[model samples]
Target: MTSHAQSQAIAPKGISRFIPILSIGVLFFIFGFITWLNGALIPFLQMVCELSEMQALFIAFCFYIAYVVMALPMAKILEKTGYQKGMSVGLGIIAIGCVLFVPAALTALFPVFLLAQFVVGSGLTILQTASNPFIVRLGNEESAAARIAFMGLLNKAAGVLAPIVFTTLVLSGLPEVNQELLNTLPEMERAALINDMSVSLIQPYVGMAVALGLLALVFMRLPLPVIEDNTVASVDTLSPASQNTQIWQYPHLVLGAISLFFYVGVEVIAGDTIGLYGSSIGVENATTLTSFTMVAMVLGYALGLLTIPRFVSQQAALLGSAVTGFIVTLGIVFADDSSLLISEILWGWTGIQQLPDTVTLIALLGFANAMVWPAIWPLALKDLGKYTAQGSALLIMGIAGGAILPVVYGGLSGLTGGQLAYMVMLPCYCFIGYYALWGCRKYTW
Candidate 1:
């Protein structure tokens, strides 16, 4: 296609085109807030439930595994309801999950908490299936990464806020709760302290449920514009045999899904496990550590906004991000764990707290991961056309990596300790680099 013709075809006529972007932007913001809260919840529940690191990671597993279990079903629902109503239904489901937190908190039951996480993850599965392609299809194909990056900015910004909000709202006035401290306490006293902390969760979750419910109502009434699938290949041009082909016939899409699996696994490990690692290493305010990763992601998103499609193509960005992620994962494993030198050099001059070199490197993974999703979505969904929903669901299913890998990391950490266990992320980035270089370009089986 000529640049001029592509511009006309890609660009929607007026300000009205931006309305769906604005609406979906709200959903992305919500997605980040709910997703990153797992970081804080991991440490908090570990202490409250008196569980080991491996058990605590089940928090992430239950939550993200829901994406795998629900993605295809949610995609089917979207076909019936279309994107707009599907999004509203997703929001309502998330609200229901938030309500579950109330009962989970009052009972101080870890299983209940896991169930709630699964419910929330299922809701997010629906939103992600609908919205990712929505953003990509909203603009010129070449600049799709830039549009997704803009949504990412909002998403990461909420991620930055989620940990701080959880700390302030949920952990305020709680005694210094750690394994060592709890171990020293009498059994009854430890139980009392945990019960108190568990009750604090009730108010915040109730508020979130109410807020999400209202958003669901707004999305229901909102007249979100339906985007036409202009890129679908016409049946008149396809041979009868070609018309019967399955989604798996596209090698690029299959490879893209596998790439996303590894990408999401490493991403979740970097964002959610940092808190657990920090706490294990004796950071006083470890629950808020996720904000550090989120801040790095926001910065990365800003850089992507400035450079993507204008200064660089999406594939180049994806390759660079994968390379960076691999390097950072090595640093996390081999860097001096006791030294705060890295943090001091990077941002300590601002009077903020300094992290050990290892923690700092893990936070840097957020910067490395920020562009991967934005870049991969455009590249993977490039020519799937009418198969977009099925392809998207396949991609969404890859999010199970987040569910599985952190548990793997938890197990590895148990065996080798936290620092060396990050080696698990190395090959994940390697595969993403492969996809950026070759897999995304392959269309045949």
Candidate 2:
């Protein structure tokens, strides 16, 4: 096949399509808000439920591992429902999960809350499967990373909002609460205070449920142009190499899936675990650090959108991001875990900034972490042809790493302490660096 045919295969039209693309971008924005909020929730749940580090991080395990259990099934479901209907259905499922949170909060039951997270993750699994590939297929294959970066702009923007909003609502006065906990308060009164705090959780989830429900209805009525995986081989024209019955035979896709596993793991470690790490180190504003991370990510995505293929190839961008991630991982681990105070940040725009040396290093990771997904999705999904969804399922399932790493970090932090636990992220980035430098191009057929 000529380059021209390949281009034709991927690009359905000469014009830049808007509605479907923007719609999917909005979905990804929701994804960022939901996924990254776990950072704040880690500490919040730990304090509220009076659980240990291991138990609190089970929030990540319950939430992200659902992607593994649901990804393949979502792929199959999308085949029947198609992307548009599948997304609407997925939104509905998320709304149901959001509603489940109300009762979980009412009972103050941790397991019930995990159930809600799993349900929400299941819905997100469907949305991710339907949307990532759909968005990638809409434009020029060479510029796919740039397009995804545009969505990342929206995504991290929401990520920036989620932590600030969630922590402000759910974790407000947490410092005072901790200080009060150190004093003698009546047990019954303390329990009453905790329950009142739990009520704060109810309103936010109610708002999410209503938003998701409305979005589902909007998608049902909206007419999106029909889309297909342009990157997939027709299977009809499958040569012996392409005709392999197993998706694993596509070495790039398999490695890509594995890469995503580590990518997500490290990304979560940087964003989610940092809050707890910050709190452990006595940063009063630790709950809001995820916003700083998200801001850094937005900067990275902005750079990616501006520079990719124009200033840097996607593979080169990945290589740089991985190297930066590895170095930041080292910095976070080896840095002095000391705390400092600042009266103003952003030229006195924000009132106070609590700078923990280790926390700052971890948050800097958002810059290193931003370009990985944009690069990974396009590289892994490259030329999967008819196996696109199958390959996508495996990659989505790799999100289970989010479940694995944070819990490991929690355990390691419990054992060796917070700063040392970040060493776990080092090898994760080394593998990512390896992929960007080698794996994506190693088995080109």
Candidate 3:
């Protein structure tokens, strides 16, 4: 084990350790609530802003690309601020971004909304960089994935609520917003309807801004235990032998980053695009479709909480996730889009809305994806010691896949339709399966 892991083994025991984990879980909840809002925002903005499918996905692009652009810089800031204060700073930044949405809504401008997304994403970059490593290093290395699974449970739970809450607040009373319907109306009436719907964003965002600002204050004063590793700040002080071991020398970490890129791509595609796909297939209240994906993920995380490090090792769980993801992606690609048979067998009696077969398959992808992040983080950061912070930043940068791949899906969906476009996920799962089986174990290139 690395020195950092050894130090963590002697970290605060009993209730003290639980406090930090609980605090970080709150941060993960914030991450999910803000990040997954893009799912509903995608179709909502597409209608409000008069965008094509590809343009609509730029909502995801501008949001996630900030991770790549700002991660290294955020790492630098964390080195100076330390993890606790940096989290407070991150929450403050997110609050600022949320406040920006007020102006974006008032003007009904897409550029302004894009700007708000970039700002919110930039803030999340800091929180993600700080909080992920914090959770991994807080306990025994063997159980780290389990800890992260618990956090994932919280995150995905928030994800389940975010879209439903968004649909309730912003879309509840609005008229249907497809272009065909708009084109059928008088021009003046269409503009007025779009303007009314756009402004519906104001109340919820203002509430988010206030709640986040208060959370920032609470986080700033929270009594969290501090870990004593040098992180990135003291890298220059290492002996020549330690300094000679460049981050590139760790093949597992590098490959893990690449694997994470594909993992996040498929995760975002499943979470965000499901709504748009449902809309195209004539599902009512398509914005709430993300809740179905989130529900699946929540179930997966609950399973992980029970089995990880006990009934199953993190590595085995990861392999299972990849295999399941591969099978589900195939179902998404080939399932008959008009069939409600899958939904009927699954939840038809619950009185919940039944999705078409293809859409149901896409939601199952969430179950396949839930374990990937939890499993990968501990495995990738294993034995990095003082390089852990840098490794975390690298993995965080891999989230760019969320920004890039969905746009690719959007463009491809335009050509081949939404169902077949899921073929893109096949190679992604293949790569993740490779990582789970072999790439994670190869420490040397």
Which has the better lDDT: candidate 1, or candidate 2?
1
Which residue pairs collide in model 2, if any?
Answer: 232-385, 233-385
Instruction: List model 3 lDDT by residue over 137-233, tens digit each.
Output: 7877788889999999999999999998998888778765666677698989989989988899999998998999998999988878765554432
Top-down lDDT ranking = 1, 3, 2
Per-residue error for 353 in candidate 3, Å, reads 0.8
Clashing pairs in 1: none
lDDT of candidate model 1 versus the reference: 0.88
- lDDT score for residue 266 of model 3: 98
Query: Lowest summed lDDT over 10 consecutive residues: which window, candidate 1?
Result: 235-244
Largest TM-score belongs to which candidate? 1
Badly placed stretches (over 4 Å) of model 3 are 1-10, 13-15, 176-180, 231-244
Superposed model 2: Cα runs more than 4 Å off: 1-16, 171-175, 179-184, 230-240, 339-352
Which sequence of candidate numbers ranks them by TM-score, best first?
A: 1, 3, 2
Clashes of each: 0, 2, 0
